[model samples]
Target chain A: MTSRKLGGHFLSVMTVVIAIVVFFPIFWMVLTSFKTEADAFIYPPLVVFQPTLENYNIALAQSGYFRQLVNTLAITGFSTAVALLLGVPAAYTLAFHPTKRSNFTLMWIMSTRMLPPVGVIVPLYIIFQNLDLFDTHFGMILLYTAMNLPLVIWMMHSFLSDIPYEILEASQIDGVTLIQEFRYIIVPLALPGLMATILLCFIFTWNEFFLAFNLTITKAAPLSVFIASFKTSEGLFWAKMSAAATITALPVVIAGWVSQNSLVRGLTAGAVK
Target chain B: MSTLQNSVPTTGTARPPDKSYLRQKLARPAIIYLIVLTQIPVVFTLIYSFSNWNLLRPDRTRFVAFQNFVDFFTNPDMPVIIRNTLVFSLSIVLFSLIFGMMLALLLNRQFRGRGLARTLLITPFLIMPTVSAVMWKNMLFNPAFGLISSFLVSIGGPRIDWINTYPMFSIVVIVTWEWTPFMMLILLAGLQSLSQEYIEAAQIDGAGPIEIFLYIIVPHLRRYIEIGVLLEVLFVLNIFGEIFVTTTGGPAIDTTTLTFDIYKEAFLRWNIGRSSAYGVFAVILANIVTIVFLRITRSGTQQNKEAA
Candidate 1:
């Protein structure tokens, strides 16, 4: 009993030690963000600081944090909504109505995701320019939606697989039309998956850098671009950069904290239950 | 995409709501907009890929017949781009899977603070690629003001230019930082699904830790490991952001991967035809890789059938 308890305690202590090492960089960055410019670079690096909001003030005031956040929210929300709209039905078809081309189509869509966005970024840029969508929220939304559709469909298909067809057929027999069945029977049953899909797509677009960096200038940049504000020809502004990084990362952190309950199940979806 | 995967509610309530409007309307306002708006960009890209279009002289652009494909294949930069892409992506996939599984094995053990450890492991992944690159470049690896350089100085050593000296190494580090969490999550799921009886039984037989790990964990983890590795390979082969921020194919064209080269050619140089040819090649290569992956791993359909 003593040996077993000792082993358990040793493992627990070891886990905490590993956690601190893994988490050190992010914590240090957050701490550094609170310091003054001089404090950030000081050799023994200041562990305790005056805890000024000055860096954050500089970040928000100069970077237009709110405006950029709105752009990110709108684009991420719109793209996820678009992806879900295309994906859920397509997943339904592939799931319940399996046909000869169904598997191939699913694989093709998945393969489409493998097409390096950069392989197509330039072409898409030119397309957007021609269409007068350069630097617009709408352009980012469309690109992100199409870019994400494949994964969305694949995940939804996986989620839909768990729902036996008999349930759907029962709903159909009870006069539930295809859309009705989808909304009532399918969506409700697959709510966990739908939420997961929406969240994943939203987070993806939320943090996407290349499209935002290359496509938008100042008009509609997200917080991802907001993080790049400290970048300059001379060099980076360390304190300000850390501040920007912290700001950009905070929302996702909070979201993750709140969503942990669902995240576990959602993340492990289609894996062994 | 974790957010989307994360959104599926496990709650069994909120059923039997009126399906009236959902059925009567069958409306997908968002999907229609999604399709219509998306068609413009995709169609325009397809059109431009075929045309001899140059943004510089838009009016003079004309249809070119296979000229781009010939030029792309014959281009001096093509080989380097292909090599760079294969190296960058393949290295990340190999290293991430190896390291991810190790981390998964460690965390899967019964231990306190495991949840916190998992969250910490996941933080790197949640960061934006651009931010991650910039953070590493200036905060961690910058010779003049970076942490590594500062640490080196304290140890009586000269600082080195990581980006200039080893651009691919720099990219690998950033890419690994971001992707290891992804593989960790997948492998963790696989590890959890495994029952503990086999391992306990092995232990009772006096099998050593290393033997049990090799004989028990590795084989049982074969499918999950394959899934993790395949997904990592599929995702990594498309890496772009760190290259964009940290290297930009720099010091020479040393870091110009296939996707990056394609981006530069088509977007920066406005060589649409050449880029598209490369794009088509990329599609072919990707298809081959995924087909091999699905077969080797017995992914999707077979898994579903077994699952059912």
Candidate 2:
């Protein structure tokens, strides 16, 4: 019993140590965001310093940081909403009324995701330019929606599949309209799954780097592009860069924390079975 | 596409089921839109791969049989690029799997503050990839006045130029830091779902911890491990921003993966033909990995069905 107690204590301490190591970089970024430029680059990495909002002020004032924040919010919000709008019904059909064709379509949609963005970016860039959609918010929304559609469908399909068929059949026997059935019965039963899917989609859209990096120059550039700009000018400003990064990462970090449980389920949907 | 049509044959002899129209109505728009969005670009990429189209010399564009592909294959850098890609991706996957399993095992045991530990551990995976890259490149890996340098100097050790001295290793470290938590979460979910009865029975049978882990837990978690590996490979193959920010695939192309190489060819060199060919190759490589992964998991399911 004593040996078992000692082993339990050892495991707990190790868990604490691992947690600190995993979190230190992000904590350091947040700490640096509050330090001045001199303090940020100081040798031995200042443990004691006067915290200042000057870096945040400069980053917000000079880098168009607020505009980029708004852009990030708008892009992530609209793309996730649009993906859900298109994906939920399609997933419902696949879950409830699956045929051989439906199964093929689901697999095909997922296979589309396997095509690397690099392969498709060339034609997308050309098409966006010719259509006068380059660097526009609508253009980004469309692209992000397309990018996340497969994931949304896959996740929603898995979630909806868990709903018992008898529930839907009873509703059908009661002569409910299809829309009424979906609005009344399906939505209530699958609400938690839908919420999880939305959160996952939003997180993905928010963090996407390549498409936003390649497609947008200024008008629709999100925080990903904004932070990349600091890379070229990185040597000159450490504190400001840290501040921008903190502002960019904090919201998604919070969202991710809230949805961590659902993430595993969503990611391992078909494969885990 | 043909398979889809065949599955829904349109013979006039028998009317389709009543629910078929409803199914089509709910599902067809999303399907058609995805096909259009995906197919047009793929077809265009296919066409461009065979042409001699340089953005700078548009008028010189012509169908150049297989020259672009031949050039891509023969380029001296091709071997290094391919090697770097495999090494970077595989190393990240391997290291993360190891660390993730360790962390998952630790978290699976009954412990105080387990919930908080899990949340803290997941923070790295949540940070944006670009932000993570920049933090590592500028704050952590910077040779002068960086965190590591500060620590080493204070300890009277040497200051290493991480990106220049060991570009591939540095990239693997940064990516592993970001992805380990992802693996841990998936593996933890798998661990939590394991049946306690078998484990208890093994314990009653006097099996040691190592024996139980090897004989029971490992086999049970195989599917989750495969899912983690296959998903990581899919995302890690397109690791552009991390390399782009830190090394820019240089100190002489030491870290350029296939996607980064394609980006350079198309954007920097403005050689659409060669880049498109590279893109096609990347697609083929990703498809091969995906098909293998699908077959493994499909067979696992088949075995499960047969067992039942």
Candidate 3:
């Protein structure tokens, strides 16, 4: 019994230590963001220093930073809303009244996700150029909506399945229309799942780099593109880069943390369960 | 788009008597939207793969009938890029899985601040890949004053230029740091779900910790491990932003994967035909993985049903 207690304690301490080690990089980045250029370049890499908001000032002052941030918010927000609007109905039908083609439709939708963004970028680029959707919010919103639709459907399908069909059937006897049934019954019951799905969609759309980098140049460019600029030619701008990175990463990080438990189920599509 | 606008009110107002029609009405918009956005572009890619259309010399455009594919397969850089993609992705998956399993085991026990530890551990994965790369490149790997370099100097070791000297290793480190959390989360779920009774029974039978882990834990966690690995394979195979920021496909194509290769062929070279051919290869690879992934997840759920 004593040995077992010791082992448990050992494991707990080790876990906390490992967590700190794992989290150190992000901590370092946030810490570095507050230091001056000279302090950031200090030989010993100061663990303690006078903190400043100057780096944040510099980072925010960079051209198009706020515009890029606003763009990111718009793209992530609209795409997630539109995806939920489209996906909820589809998942509802598939869950409550699965047709003969329901399984096939779900499989095909998921398989579309398997198609890497790179495989279709060449044609997408050409099409976007021709259709005048290349750098527009409309174009990105369309793509991100498509991007997140599969996830929303799959997750919401599982969530909706847990809702007993008897509720809807009973409501139907009382002359409840489909929209009313949805508005009154489904949304409230599935609110937690819906929130999780929305957060998942938000994180993915926000952090997406490949499509956003390829598709947008200026008008619809998000913070991902803006952060990539730190990679070249700013010549050792560590503090500024950290500040920019902190800004870009802040929203998604919080979202991911808040939704961590649902994340596993959503990501694996209920495989673990 | 018109279909979307038309279908909404029809579903809301019409009140169809037929249930099947209502089902179709509810589902059609999403399916059509997906088909238009995803399927149509792929068909265009298929069409473009056969032609020789460089943006620089558009007047010379012509359908060359697999010539671009032939050129891609026969290119000397093909082997190098393919090798890099496989090695880079596989190694990261392997390392992260190992580390993730260890961490998962550690965290599986009842502990103080367990929730806090788990929250902090997943932070790297939450950060955008571009920002992760930039942060690592400038703050952690910069030879002049990077934290790692400063640490090395403090230890009386030479300050090495990580990306320049060890490009592939540097990328692998950055990506593995980002992905280990994903593996840990899935495996930890699997661990938590394991029945405590079985472990207690094993312990009563005089089994050591390692023995119980190897026998009881490993067999039970197989599905979770497989799901984690295959999913990680699918995601890591397409790693682009990290590589783009740090190495730019490196000192002479040392770190270029097929995805990056496609980006270069399409954007830099302006060779639409050739890039589409490369894109076809990427599609083929992802499809292969997707097939295997589907089979594994299907079997996993089936097993869960059987166990239940």
Candidate with maximal TM-score? 3
**Tens-digit lDDT string for candidate 3 (B1-308):** 78645554333445457754685568789999999999898888889999999999999999899999999979999999999999899999999999999989888877789999999998888999999998888778878777888899899999999999999999999999999999999999999989999999998999998999899999999989988998899899888999999999979999999999999999999999999999988888888888887888877667768999
Q: Which stretches of candidate 1 lie over 4 Å from their true place?
A: A1-12, A97-100, A164-188, A229-236, A256-273, B1-52, B57-67, B293-308
Per-residue CA lDDT of candidate 1, range B140-248, in tens?
7777777777888889998987777888998898898788877777777778877899989998999988999899888877776776676667667666667777877
Task: Give stretches of model 2 more than 4 Å off.
Answer: B1-20, B299-308
Q: What digit string (tens of lDDT, one per residue) describes model 1 on residues A1-273?
A: 999788778767776676677667678788888988888887766786688889889877864776897888888888888778877777777777776876666666655565556555666676678888889988888788886676677778788888998897776556655555665689899887777777767667777887787788888888787666544422346888888788887776666655443443444333433
Q: TM-scores for all candidates?
A: 0.85, 0.94, 0.96
Q: Candidate 2, which CAPRI tier?
A: acceptable
Name the best candidate (by lDDT). 3
Superposed model 3: Cα runs more than 4 Å off: A233-235, B1-16, B306-308
The share of true interface contacts that also appear in candidate 2 amounts to 0.67
lDDT (10s digit) by residue, model 3, range A129-239: 999999999999999999999999989998999999999888877766677678779999999999999999999999999999999998999999989888974337777
- Candidate 3, after superposition: displacement of residue A265 in Å? 1.4
lDDT values for all models? 0.72, 0.85, 0.89
- If both were scored by TM-score, which would come out higher, candidate 1 or candidate 3? 3
* Superposed Cα RMSD, model 2: 6.0
| Error of model 1, residue A199, in angstroms | 1.6
